[model samples]
Target: MVDKADKTAKVAPAKVKGGKKTSPAEFIRQVQTEGRKVVWPTWPETVRISIFVFIMMIILSLFFLGVDSAFGAVVSWLLTLA
Candidate 1:
């Protein structure tokens, strides 16, 4: 089955006469049409997403800090024993 999105993704070659290139206006119009079809997130939704990601980063940072301190202490104790 052919999907609508896949169909829209394809573009045929522009017609050329006497080796002349296509105009920029046609290219910009095509891009704007495609841009309109995209779905964008709302500001409130974006803020919620940002907060969730920030919290996750803080949690992971604390975890790695604890693991690093434990390793450093063990290495210092082993050097003193030598």
Candidate 2:
């Protein structure tokens, strides 16, 4: 039977076989290659996203303001009853 203790045990990170390190130039080259693979949004897409974000922010702020005002009124009325 498989041991439950072994199933729950944490595995350690594997060590480098030869302890070889990458040079700074090689690291920068790898970074540039990875950066090139990234897809960036166009100007119109960016502007549309920014407008959508601002609209949602205004809507959420108004919603929270109404909710806070209702709660404040309820608490104020409750205090008067005591």
Candidate 3:
């Protein structure tokens, strides 16, 4: 029979490649190197996307408001019949 305590015990972390841990300074250097490789969008592209998002938000809010008003009117009429 297996021991319940062994099943509940914490497992050790797996060893790194070549059993070497990365130093904090080396990690930061690697992060900066990766950051330099990132591509950023132009200002015009950012503005265009922002405008599109704002327009879609306004359109969706108007659509939901119309639907909610219609439903509210129907509920109010049904309550009047009771």
Q: Rank the candidates by TM-score, best first.
A: 2, 3, 1
Better of 1 and 3 by TM-score: 3
Provide backbone clash counts, one per model.
0, 0, 0
User: Could you tell me the lDDT of residue 2 within candidate 3?
Assistant: 94
Which ranges of candidate 3 are over 4 A from the true structure?
1-23
lDDT of 3 by residue, 1-82 (tens): 9999999999989887778998999889999999999999899999999999999999999999999999999999999999
Candidate 1: worst-modelled 10 consecutive residues by lDDT: 13-22
Can you tell me which runs of candidate 1 are displaced by over 4 Å? 1-33
lDDT of each residue in 1-82, candidate 2, tens digit only: 9999999999986654466677789889989999999999999999999999999999999999999999999999999999
Q: Tell me the whole-model lDDT of each prediction, alpha carbons only.
A: 0.92, 0.94, 0.96
**Candidate 1 lDDT tens digits, 12-75:** 7776865687579977997999999999999999999999999999999999999999999999
- Top-scoring candidate (TM-score): 2
| C-alpha RMSD by candidate, in order | 9.2, 2.8, 5.7
